[model samples]
Target: MRHYFSDIFLRKAVIALSGLLMLAGGAAAREFTVNTISDEKGNARTPVISDTGLVAWQAYSLHDGDTPVHQRVDVLSAPPNTRRSDIIIWQDGKTNNLTATDTRLTGRCEQPVVGGNAVAFLAWFKNETDLGMPFTLSIPDKTDEMKQMESDYPTLFDPPKPPPVSTVEAEAGEAAPPPEPETPEAAATNGLNENLQRQMWRDSGQAADIVYYNTARGQLERLTSGNRHYCSPVVSDAGVAFQCARGWPYGYEMVAWPASATNLVQLTTNYYYVLHPDLHGNELVFQGWDGNDYEIFRYRFDTGQMEQITNNSFDDTAPVVWDGRIAWVGYPTITAEIFYWADGALRKISERTEDNTAPSIWEGQVVWQAYDDTDMEIYYFNGRRTIKLTSNTWDDLAPQIRDGLITWMSYVDNWDSEIMAFDLSDNIAVQLTNNEFEDSYPQTAGGKIVWQTIGAEGSFIQMAVPAAAP
Candidate 1:
């Protein structure tokens, strides 16, 4: 009886030792180095990395009473008058202020995207109408009649439209005569009111223009001029593509700077709005207005053809392109779902009832965040099957995949985000960062990850590389 009991105890000991060894091996596999790539004093945000280890971000100096606000797009704030945001580039262990030498660029540069030897961004200039002087109305004291008129028509101060021509006038061969000109006092009053209203809609008296840093030429180049609002720039080896506002009520059109082009080209003129353009090689994809909802529009520079990849009443948005494959979030029903286009056919990759959004695709792999009843979880779709990478209560958002390694910012403990990564080959998940600060917007390229970290000092750019990373 004693011999049999010893045999059973020894077998249990071996199994427990084997389990301990496996856990230690998994921990060792996740060990990596995290580095701060941007200057702490520069207050960097929106860091982007290229496949060649090139990094670019928007940096600005914050003064006293300056409240820093981080955003997925460009920073939206009334920045200090003494300083403006600029683009910073890091390459080969050295950093360069990309726009410091360009005196002509008197705007806040943001949204830097790097591809190959180019870094494209948006530079917002202060509107010419915005003088340093305080805005005031010098209208004389209102009489009782004037007060009554204002009370009767709340829009009395609005710029009035000209009266429509009568039917009799249209039937006549003579052209309809213009309305009498306004008095000087009336014109000044109307102009003041219009300017005040327009100023309210502007970005704190600023309008953006697309600009790029040509590292090959060692110079900064402005792609679009005339202070139009051009934003959401995506860079590629071919060139840059972005959306430009068509003025007035603010409709957007797709614009591109083709490879080796001296001038800008407007890709879409459908008068409808376009958003979130992704450029890869010679193919461009974006979500365009399609009467009822947004639909995917694919453009080919090689053939100069624009094809509507999706035609549905449901809204399709946030489309991303890799090689010839396209992935986007589609609202086939009331809930958002993941859809992809490949091999000249469309496929629905996700069937969740909850909202699934922010899909990133590479090769045949797709990764996105889906609301999994408990919290936002990261979901992965390989070429063959689908799998849930994370199942914790914490919210995992903005999953990006590159070279079989997926990275995202996972909100932890007290709503503070930390960067996390999962390797598809090894089927191992690892936390890339753990600190008191918030690390968000983890972008992956060539096995490297870059993100924006909000710290006590200010927001800065951080990069993480695995021990086995290429």
Candidate 2:
């Protein structure tokens, strides 16, 4: 390899600046530190960490005395799991509180996902605004009502007076309230990355629409709407892919969009439902029902080529794609086991399936939750062999991997949980949190971990990193 002076100088400078130095071919041993992102007044949970060290979370702040009435989401840089002091919650720019108050905020926005550019969620808004060209529900005319009544009725002469109109019926066709001018903070981060394609949802139980936020152009473009449910959206640098349902089984089809929702692409519109899309540049992998059973499929964006990954008579689900390799749960013999697909070949990763599920892959390495007959443990795979990483009786679930760092949740119970991480470089897995609090939904990326912990005060997001970095 040719050595350039500027490249060598920059490499040294980056090592000095980030305080991270690695040996030639061995893994580096790292101590971990946890950083609190939100606490006290509100709860911050559902955080996602990007491979570049950026973190975003959804929080409910108790702006009032004890009620967490102020709901918002925030994103900040936490490369080394640095604690953020100047945190600002981002909300829709509608100043009339429609986005905050009147809308029936559902779990649609509950999925707080982050990628390279911005944080996205399912924004459930079901208020007067989205009700569409409103109409009055006026009482029937006096003469028309009297004639409609049967002559046999003795009370036909005495017309019943109309009761008070309901708040919803009365406000029909009412103009929306004027919004406040752009606040200094709102204008700054309104559409942080107007070019990055983001998937979001607007579900109100009765009605919903799946949409994508165009970061480069700052537009929330709708992909599908009208009496339907859509979810589990995954996006790559190329486009966004999600699953939609139109009630029953017709709605669960895999759909895609490039930069704008207007350029909508329905990858699968068959009778079977396609769910849980995993998108990684130029490739989209998901599992869908193929008439009789569920199997995994992959689609190439550049050439519009589609291929079935698994053909067995089992349910292949929850696939996560990284680069080109894919990992998912395959239910062979009805016993769920971790499986992988690479180089046109599908193979099982687990030695024996005792209910193994929730597999995630990064650069061909896999991690998953498995039950070794009695205890629930998280397992790891090095693309060659499999090993049980944890031997605890306590349940360790939802293990994620990135850059050799593995993270998962250790729960004594549902509310009493902890975030644990293991570094492949040093072959050391340490409990990142050990206290009287609830920490779960851990994700690993860029050699760092992010998760949420709920205490008496409120739920907060905490990040961990190898403690050697300054």
Candidate 3:
């Protein structure tokens, strides 16, 4: 009887040890609330986490008391988020005093990117416009254009029919000779740049500008002024660079204001639909629409010259650049692929034809969203091998990588989003958040993760730590 009891006890010990081992091997995730408000109306989105466990995010008033009315999309549907939005900072598990609600009136604060000791964000100045300006489109010779149009007009037909015959320039097989050098005005009026048309919508009011927060000084400084609407401000120790939204058919252009200079310099103004810019040091890379299709472009701030990295007619966009290399998503057909550029050569990084996009780069590695499964999955490519980070049925999208660590948003059972992280070294994919509500746009650097979430009660900026170390 004693021997039988001893044998049972030994079996139980083995089972308990096995359970502990399994628990240790599994990805362990924990949460830390970075920002919460008294009203609990702060709906935060797109929080950036740094290597030192510092987090910055943009939050808008949940206005908890106000009845939720389908969340506004149109100008008339709701007030500008700027009025309710502010930037929040979280450090050492405590919400910091650094809030970007410096404006007294209703305004917006968005896309807070943390780099080193400074946090760069997007902010609207209520009635204030940006002082620095972007380059304007060169005006064409209207008088000459008017005369040409008058001469080219055909006699009106009963039904305004097409021209009876092809114009001299339109004759097939015999192409028109390229025009000789002309004045800038005449050239501007010419259709040479007709491809640079604006394809996106324009807002009624002015756009938001970039604002920099000095965490060390605890001071907020406006980096850009009323010139144009800017998006995705990438900051390095050098300074800040972003895409400025120009009027339609022109789309957005890359612009920058160096730390040494007060005036904003237009990096690209020639009409291409430049968008989705990322910068590292004095080198900048962005995707642009060259009339017929989208292509990736690289620009050097010191040299003031830009190179067309990808010339294909397919749409290549959402480029991320670092250490003079770039990666972007290229859509050849309905589906998309990943493309990378390095050392003056560009190559297809992703061979899959399914929809893949929203690429981010770290060191020399690249990460993107791949729609291989029912929901989008995260993929990582380090030039040689492509690895799938997540295989869940739910969508995992908007991946960002830094130092081989990847972070993104994923939707699970209830369809509400959660923040996830994958450490490349350990190959452990950790679900950072298992929130009942939706959490999204997580940014990870080193071992830290930050994201935004909103529920019926309110909105918030959340963080996951020790994330800064891995």
Candidate 4:
């Protein structure tokens, strides 16, 4: 039987962090600090960290107090929409609210992916403006008999109506006075204003499109526009690759925005439900439906060609690309397994019967989580041997590897999770966080790791630097 061990459980049971720790056998002792990058007002989540120490994430802020009250009847009973999402970036001890600075971005902006100094994300209006047309609730006109009934039974038909309440007032438990009837001129002006507002929302540069911060020009640029949804953008040396909905029958197609270029290229016209695209260098990889099952597909930006890497009955999805190699999850039977494609050859690296998914590839190494009949465990492939990096009762998920350093999130319970890391060269595993808060979704890059922590106050982005071995 293979001996299994958990660093998190062992560290918590044995070692108590007192600023530093001394290791046995004269091994190097590690010391590091966890720094909070986001403020408490907005609950930050899903942070993306680049090699350049630039961190980007999505955060939700409280809605403004003075919200406009439309005269429409539906607006009176609509549920409160009191939170708005914005993309935030932190770099070099400075924080910038990217969505707040841009006047045109007037809705929920999220799903930020940072590469180098640039950040790419998706932004769309959260209001009726995203409908792309003026939305009007059709209220049936009351018949003459209804009007007579109201006139005859004034007490029952016309009870005192409560005043309309704004979101702030409702939260504060305060009642607001009803507004007076609008004049004909005021109604006309309001209608014109509504149309202008809709137009501005629709024409808001890159609404429902791929928006990215241009490092060269120091401004946000819209990669694609029009009324369509783009999903799962991945950044690389070539540029960004994402799946875009091309309407019905067409489904979704893969699109790419070349680095430092204004022109957009549609890499796939099949539009067969492409999802979770990953880009590295000039090669873009993703899983596309092929009528039978999902298969792995790769597109080369330099050659303008598409290649189908896998063609089995099983569904192969969530491909992550690095250099020219790709790693993903494939179901050989009823259980999922880790699969890899490199040097024009495909191989199943995982030998376990349990489910293995969310594979991350860097250089030639791959890391992912696998089920071991009890809970999830982290597994790794160091280009030769398959190694189990984590073995614990808790579920270890979202393993990311970069330059021989592997990071993952281990959950002690449904609401308690922590970040753990393993160094390949030293063959040492370390628990990076030990606190009451839930730390998860660890992403490693350029020897630096970033993750989000959820606490009672709010979720925040945190960065940790692992000390080098002495």
The lDDT per prediction is 0.72, 0.61, 0.63, 0.71
- Model 2: ten consecutive residues of lowest lDDT: 10-19
lDDT of 3: 0.63
TM-score for each predicted model, relative to the true structure: 0.76, 0.69, 0.70, 0.73
lDDT of each residue in 91-181, candidate 1, tens digit only: 8879999776666667467888888778888775434333212212122355576567657744433334433466744665655588677
Best by TM-score: 1
Across 183-257, the per-residue lDDT of candidate 2 in tens digits comes to: 343335556432121111212235544434434545444444434565776665566776766343133777676
Sort by TM-score, best first: what order? 1, 4, 3, 2
Off by over 4 Å in 4: 1-26, 63-82, 125-207, 412-415, 467-470
lDDT of 4: 0.71
Record all residue pairs in model 1 with backbone atoms less than 3 Å apart, i.e. clashing. Answer: none
- Give the Å error, residue 76, model 1: 8.5
Candidate 1 has a TM-score of 0.76
lDDT of 4 by residue, 1-470 (tens): 11111221224322121112222335543444467778743478999888787889988766443332222232224335444678888887788887776666665687999877778898764332332222122223555765677687454433444454657437856677667865433554434554333343332233376777845667776666545667778776568777777543346777787787666677766535778888777888888998779999888878888889998878998898888899999887898889877898888889764889889998888989888888887788878767776665678889999866788887755457888766555555677776788898999887778898876666778777754445
- What are the runs in model 2 whose C-alpha is more than 4 Å off? 1-28, 61-63, 67-108, 126-205, 211-227, 249-251, 412-415, 468-470
Residue 325, model 4, lDDT: 90
Tens-digit per-residue lDDT, 190-250, candidate 3:
5543122211122335567777766666776676665666788887666778877655434
TM-score of 2: 0.69
Listing every candidate in turn, what is its Cα RMSD in Å to the true structure after a full C-alpha superposition? 14.1, 16.1, 14.0, 14.1
